[model samples]
Target: MKKTIIISLLSAAMMTSCFTTGDPRDGGIFWSPSKADARIGQLNQTNNEAMHQKQKAENRNKRLKAEKVRELNTY
Candidate 1:
C-alpha cells in the first residue's frame, strides 16, 4: 500500500515534468510554418556543406591515387 502510493506519486511527477519543459523551437505546443521552413533550410544547408566537403575529399584522394600510379609507372 505504501509502495503503491509512492510509485503513483513518482509516476505523476515524472509525467508532469515531461509536459512542462522542452525546446520550444521544436514547435512544442505552438508550431508555425515559418519556423518549420527555417528549420528545413538550416538542415538542407548543413547537408549541402557536408556533401561538398566529402566530394572535395574524394577528389583529392583520387588525385593522390593517380599521382601514385604515375610515379610507380615511371619507376
Candidate 2:
C-alpha cells in the first residue's frame, strides 16, 4: 500500500511538471502577445514602403510634365 501511494505521488508530480506553468502549448492562463503583433508590424512596414513608392511616382510625373512644358515653350 505504501509503495502504491509513493508511485501515485511520483506519477502525479511528473504529470504536473510536464504540464508546466507559463507554457502556451499547455494552454496556461499566461497573457503573452501573439503572432499578430509581428504580422501587424510587417503590414505597417509594407504600407510605408508603398507610400514611399507612390510619392516617388508622383514626383516623377510632375517632373516629366514640367520638362514637357519647358520643351514646348522652347520649340
Candidate 3:
C-alpha cells in the first residue's frame, strides 16, 4: 500500500553506501608480500571480477610451475 511504499523509500534513503569491505576494526587484512615484492595493488583493489580471478589463478599456477621445475632440477 502507500504506507509500505513510503517506508521502503525511507529505508533506501537511510542507507549510506552500497559497497563495503575490509573492516579495519577486525584487524586490517593481512595482504602478504607487501605491495613492493608482490608488485600488485591497483588490481587487488579493482572492481573487476575476471581480472582479479585471472590474476589469482596465474599466481598460483606460476608458483606451482616453479616448484615443479625446481624439484625436477634437484632430482
Best by lDDT: 1
lDDT of each: 0.78, 0.75, 0.65
lDDT of 2 by residue, 1-75 (tens): 999999999988776655323334546543335544665678799999999999999999999999999999998
- The alpha-carbon root-mean-square deviation between model 1 and the true structure, to one decimal in Å, is 8.8
Give lDDT tens digits, candidate 3, residues 1-75: 999999999878665434333433434334334533343455456647778899999999999999999999998
Question: Stretches of candidate 2 above 4 Å error?
Answer: 1-32
**Model 1 CA deviation exceeding 4 Å by range:** 1-27
Q: What's the residue-level lDDT of 64 in candidate 3?
A: 100
Q: What is the lDDT of residue 27 in candidate 1?
A: 36
Could you give candidate 1's per-residue lDDT for residues 1-75 as a string of tens digits? Answer: 999999999988776655321335553554456766777788899999999999999999999999999999998
Give the TM-score of each candidate.
Answer: 0.61, 0.56, 0.37
List the lowest-lDDT window of 10 residues for candidate 1.
Answer: 18-27
Quality of model 1 by C-alpha lDDT: 0.78
lDDT of 1 at 41: 86
Ranking by lDDT: 1, 2, 3
Ranking by TM-score: 1, 2, 3
Candidate 2 lDDT = 0.75
